[model samples]
Target: MLRLFSFGSGARLTMRTSEDAPLVICGHGMVAQRLIERLVALGHPFNGIVVFNAEPFSAYNRIQLSAVLANEIPEADLALKPQSWFARHKVSVFNHEPVTRIDTDRGTVTTAHGRVQAYSKLVLATGSRPSSLGISGEDLDGVLTFRTLADTRALINAASTHKRAVVIGGGFLGLEAAEGLRARGMAVTLLHRSDHLLNRQLDTTAGDMLKGLLAQRGLNILTGQSPAALLGKSRVAAVQLNDDTVMSTDLVVIATGITPNIDLARIAGLQCNKGICVDSRMRTSHPAVYALGECCQFGTHTFGLVEPGFQQAQVLAQHLCQTSEATEFSPGSIATRLKISGIPIFSCGRVQAGPATEDIQWQDRPEHRYGRLLVEQGQLVGAVLMGDTASGPWYADLIDSGRDISGYRDTIAFGQPYCEAAA
Candidate 1:
């Protein structure tokens, strides 16, 4: 242990290094790999490196999980950086081994293999765990959750033989699961707890409209129903709804939601509420410890999606590289965009407005187009669009900048012609 001085509160502290002081990072998820690239660009060749509980092969692009499953792309094509990238950069990776615990006071991390190592700086990018439905038969062999590449492969295998597939939950993941199963030529049935599909992102009318469109295409959409249990001894056979309705299926894919992986952070006694609470700089309660990706909660929001997680990675990378100008995530107004089966859906900011706020919408159900804009005090607060998400970028920019659309409110509701008229 060596004594170190810091300006913060003018306090002196002792730091421990394992002969060589290195910046240790945990988890090889998206955020962790990005941080490594930034550090390398900064010309900071790590003297000692500790990568805990990750595959030694370096990080890969998880976004292509479905594409790989569908055989549209290979696994190698999905990798964000190749194995040679990590080797050439001299960043040691601990493949297939995950860190089980961390001791902040001792500055040590214990891997599942019982190897305990010390670190000077630690970054947590453990990502998220699938939100499982705590129901009977959840552990059945045929039940699956699509979160990792391994899960995708298993799902594709099971789906090939399964004639009927019942998907639990109708959020983004649920819909994706349904689409993937459909692509596999399996009869797909979607069971959702909400009255409409994508209730979280769309209003009731919009959700029902989308549900109708999906139903027209031979997809079964069941809404406002809860799964009582999974019917099968060792495998999923049927999904029992709340009303004792048994929907027979050979496989069940639960895409309910996800919770951040904060078990290690919690055990370390780090201050956490909802997620490992971190500041805009992605710094946790502990001084030398930082957390990024889905495991972190910043500004009262937990990003379950990948884009914001990537943004957090960039922010932390710059900060760690000592070239950070803005230590906060500038996401430019958080947006919800789902692109499943070549269909575009974009929802951003506040879709619902109170009495003081105003909402303008245009409906073309015949053409399967729905668009709504929420304006408060003549400024764009949020917007939602389905089938016609081409204007998503423009609306997103308006929401991010708090641009006023009072002058063109009526024109904007009519779609592109409004932009043309305004121009």
Candidate 2:
């Protein structure tokens, strides 16, 4: 039998009985939710499942957070699973309670409310927290960071009263926030320390093109600049740049980057670098423990994208279910697609060409389209598609297959159909 009880300070406690089948999960985010869904798909009994959610709400689609800010979707639409779904699955969730400590020796986890839960197997999907710039006056009233539904609400409320806003960072999150705020009729100035936007994802050319497109949408892009300090009396009124330039602003959104939430794992003596270390099987240093999502490091890789986390969930679920065909996780070629409407940009695998790599590009200036393919030793290694991304999936497939395209090199830039016809 499963029972719900109110615990300390409005925290909800979900009691479950399954002494023999114990699996305790820490954190309730997209990765954790996916892990639960995958486990259930693999026939793991729901009675065995116990989840600790630090947030008051259930798992929501964080990928659509920008949409929420843009008013394209409501907060309710962000939920990944409804309350009825949990009730139907018989999964016990402790909301507004975070697992404060992990007692690996005793196979127990202590919650914020001092509730100790025992587990036969433990999984950490704590995800990542937004990184701060460590600048002065960051603690002001209007300084914000976007990571959760609550953050989105706060930004929306701030936007309602704020007329001008300055967004730090030109990465995906920063750009999304800038666009969302602009959609809300806020004058937005985007500052990036890099010479070009999305330095990690796109080359200078594509990035510049992106800047142009965004400029057309009324977003102020300031590159090679960073805020030295946020200035105001009690709230952020303006940002002082490193060059002593003062840009008056009503709100500040810091989307610099994210740091993995590994404090709990570190405190529990789990091996960690930038994130919790795990093997290809998603197993942590301890035998009965595993870690995944943005909080985990597999080899030299730490993933920030949803696809990798989802893949890890599937692999970990298979292992937990003791599937006959369980295999080690091998990450596929990750593709990034911007969620902003009207801006069609797709980047997969490598975006830059090394000395040994050859680049094939096709640019249609009139159509505002750009495509580039990186070939190494006769095989497609990477590709970038802007404006027209009809060939994104086909390019991703070719990169994954590692097939030599030397024969079709002449017509490959035309797209998959052209290459196929030529072959």
Top lDDT model:
2
- Per-residue lDDT of 1-423 in model 1, one digit per residue for the tens? 454534355654444564455778888877787778777877764575567645544577776676666566777787887667777887878888889888897777878876666777788888888888888989988999988877887888987777999989998788877877787788999999988889878887778888888888778988998899999988878889889999888999988999888888999998888788888888999987899888889878887777887788778777766673747875567788886566678999886778997878888899878899888998988899998898887888888988777778778866656776776
TM-score of 1: 0.90
Angstrom error of the Cα, residue 335, model 1: value is: 0.8
Candidate 2 residue pairs in backbone clash: none
lDDT of candidate 2 over 1-423, digit per residue (tens): 554656467987675433453799999899999999988888884346889989998889999999999989888889888888877877888989999999897677889989977787899999999998998999999999999989999999988987999999999999999999999999999999999999888888888888888898899999999999999999888999999999998999999999999999999999999999999999999998999999999888888888889999999999989899887887778888764446788889998899999999888765768898999999999998888888898889889999878889878888888887877
**lDDT value, candidate 1, whole model:** 0.80
C-alpha TM-score for every candidate = 0.90, 0.94
Q: At residue 110, what lDDT does model 1 achieve?
A: 73
Per-model lDDT: 0.80, 0.89
